[model samples]
Target chain A: MLSPKRTKYRKAHKGRIHGLSTSGTTLNFGQFGLNALQPERITARQIEAARRAITRHMKRQGRLWIRIFPDVPVSVKAAETRMGSGKGSPEFWVARVHPGRIIFEIDGVSDTIAHEAFALAAAKLPINVKVVARQGEGA
Target chain B: MANAIKLAATARDRAGKGVARETRRQGRIPCVIYGAGQAPVMISVDAAAVARDVHASNFVTKTYDIDVGGVSHHVLPRDVQFHPVSDRAIHIDFLRIDAASLINVSVPFEFKNAETSPGLKRGGALNIVHHEIEVRCRPDQIPAHITIDLAGLEINASVHLSGVSFPEGVVPHVSEKDFTIATIATPSALRGKEDGEGDGAASPAEAAKA
Candidate 1:
């Protein structure tokens, strides 16, 4: 799973995602992209799972880019623990994704392969996604 | 010069978010034609017609003859705003142009002879640095697209702006440096093989395991 090596604070506050993403909305590096259709907090494990699915479907033939990173540390309280003991230790990392963000990009693959790869990857994600090709390129 | 595509549109009296939304609800795309010292004209074109054109190749470079309420306007597509989620055309901006007008337009590159490139044959990736190059030319002289030949390129070889040939009277907008347009880059799998043989440093995965 992807996580930060170090951080300024051990635990961070959970933030809210609002509105559509203003950046990372366009396909900058690849010919095909998987676009987010709703806002959600995606865990590092989920990201890794999606990446594995995409790479496995592509047979590692084309290049892939994960546009979003799991930077937010999510902490949890232990089971059956009655009261608050300050804050629970950081358990995992998550990425707050906004609507219209391009979560994954792929290149050097045929349109059919790219679409299939994205479809396999989308099953691992929590939000709805659509496969998009770069404008003026293959549809 | 390529023949201008003809599109019919209706003039609209109002312009705003509400009006634009209303226009979209009626299956029309809100558009504006401005430039050449003339007042801007607010119009609405058929949603399907404009969407087809926008999705086509070299949309901005294509010239259009827009007939607004029986008045003809020669224009070039300047910008398109798409709905974030639906990816629908929400708004469009068109620039009025004429024969004498010299405009700077971004022309896409059409790479040719990729199969003949020695670099591509060796499992190298054609990493495009610039998909399009901005050029200054008369509206009528704007080439549909610039061609970049990749016939004899080898791994790590680069094609720069200086090496490209443009049509008569069309010149690259940037005159400062010979910027790279594309390169035959080594694939990551090939890079890994070279690195393992050349260096003793532990890979990221190996380091993580440790």
Candidate 2:
């Protein structure tokens, strides 16, 4: 007796092994919580660190990075725009990571040293760092 | 001797979108001044004066003396909203700067020695990934423009973020070292594929078929 020829192999196995995704559109990573430092609580040291981190990262990476430090007691209007009354700004400080970019979203922490540490850490990233911010309604 | 334009403006009494629309109908641009730890003050700027500045690529970081309500504010461009279809600046935002406050702004990048660079002479092309970089410094310490020197770069040579130098008090926002800003690369062969013209000389089989 002759065996039945296998005609449906490609169709049955193709495009299914990848599991749960549809083609054509990009993948969605979803959102995460973000924090902003209180202006009055931020220290000079944090601001200095932020500056240093930005400088150092720029040196190690071949891309330009921007340190976005919000002015303390930022105007209500400015805050509305910067933080966006809707969901707040997704990024406060941004840096270059090869083939992509990295941003830091820190709320209530816009200080000299905090910014410095953030930058210093960003410079050491071995892989892509995409810092996104998602702020919920306040308590 | 210099192209100095005197413009007039009005202080916005009611601050909101409705007021802004009325201002625009009168051929004016709504703007605000903030910084120096003071509340943001809403003002109107001459629509024409703002349109002129918007034409420049480095308008945002560039300093300007804006007179509003009989008071002049030392400010820099902050943000601008543009018309979606026309892409013309419809609204503008200005940030007041105290000479002493450290400010972060992006400076225009200017390439120098490009014509004589080895990369270009050797058939390699220069690709500028970025046209500008943001910097932080005092108002007086702000740089007018940033310079990128492409001297003897060879094919595949890249200039990174760390390679750039900043004027005193002006520093890049990134903390990484050796981040790339621009690169010299061999031009893509696919560029001419659509037109079927290039140095990729037709294959023997293709030549024979032709």
Pick the lDDT winner: 1
Report DockQ per prediction, comma-separated: 0.37, 0.01
List runs of model 2 lying over 4 Å from the truth: A1-139, B1-7, B190-210
- Residue lDDT tens for model 2, A48-81: 3443454343222212222223222211233425
RMSD of 2: 22.0
Off by over 4 Å in 1: A4-9, A83-85, A137-139, B194-210
User: Which lDDT value does model 2 have at B74?
Assistant: 77
Worst 10 residues of 2 chain B by lDDT: B198-207
Candidate 1's residue-wise lDDT over B1-210, tens digit each? 588889999999998889988999999999999999999999999998877778655888989999998899999999988777888888999999998979998888999999999998887778888888889999999988899999999989999988999999999998659999988877666665654432222223334765
Best by TM-score: 1
Pairs that collide, model 1: none
Model 1, C-alpha of B70: deviation from truth (Å): 2.5
Candidate 2 has what TM-score? 0.52
